[model samples]
Target: MGLEVVPNTREVLIDLYTKTLKEIQVVPEDEGYKKAVESFTSHRPKLIEKKLGCGQVEELIEEAQDELTLIGKMIVIEEKKWLVDEDED
Candidate 1:
């Protein structure tokens, strides 16, 4: 979507984004990785609203890193069913 990824020397934001997607293959049938995908995707619209002057890349990367990390953690849990349980309620 937008540029929510701007990895700096100390940040692995974009790297994490790609890695997360790879680990959790975002598909419709399985909501496991889907949950993480939604989180990463949710920021797309908001990020699209911003207008950066080439100085926002680092910040964007930092932000993307945070979002991607969470998704990565979700993948590690391997319990998408638990996430679904909350939705059922």
Candidate 2:
């Protein structure tokens, strides 16, 4: 089956990528996760600007959403870590 075209794929992707980049700052810069996320999140927008094919753009959008989910999980884990540290004090 063909992918259904979203009316605002570019806007959606930009918003997602932007939020992901912002949220990822909570992660330590030296961590591989942060570096990997920064690399790909920065690259996806260029792909959009280049006007990649619909299938490729859709794939990027899905990947962006997945990354955002991962960022959320990372933030939660960090918060929990902080709470545990405080409790041990």
Candidate 3:
């Protein structure tokens, strides 16, 4: 897995999610972002728990990458929805 961008200097995952939500126009609602966060939280540990009791940052990156894939798709859909709405006005 590749190294993911550092999620800001905050010590909490929720903080990271909150900050990320502010930076984007689409999927800013906690439900959407929270779903992504939940996806990462579940899958990340599954991969991590695979290794005795220790996991590497790379695993976290993998988990992040997976979550990003969903976010990107959702963002595209949201943007398209916004564009269509504007056209109808």
Which candidate number has the best lDDT? Answer: 2
C-alpha RMSD of candidate 3: 6.7
Report every candidate's CA lDDT: 0.55, 0.86, 0.53
* Best by the TM-score measure: 2
* Tens digit per residue, CA lDDT, model 3, 47-80: 4335523344544444445555666787788789
Name the Cα RMSD for model 1: 8.6
The deviation in Å at residue 63 for candidate 1 is 2.0
lDDT of 3: 0.53
Q: What TM-score number comes out for model 1?
A: 0.38
Give one digit per residue, the lDDT tens place, for model 2 in 1-89. Answer: 75666779889999999999998998988889999999988887887888675456667778788999988998899899999999999
How many residue pairs clash in all the candidates, one count each?
Answer: 1, 0, 0
- What tens digits encode model 1's per-residue C-alpha lDDT throughout 1-89? 55544335233544555565565564444565577566654444344456544345565565666656766675556567668888899
Decoy 3 TM-score against native: 0.42
The stretch of ten residues in a row with the least summed lDDT in candidate 2 is: 51-60
Better of 2 and 3 by TM-score: 2
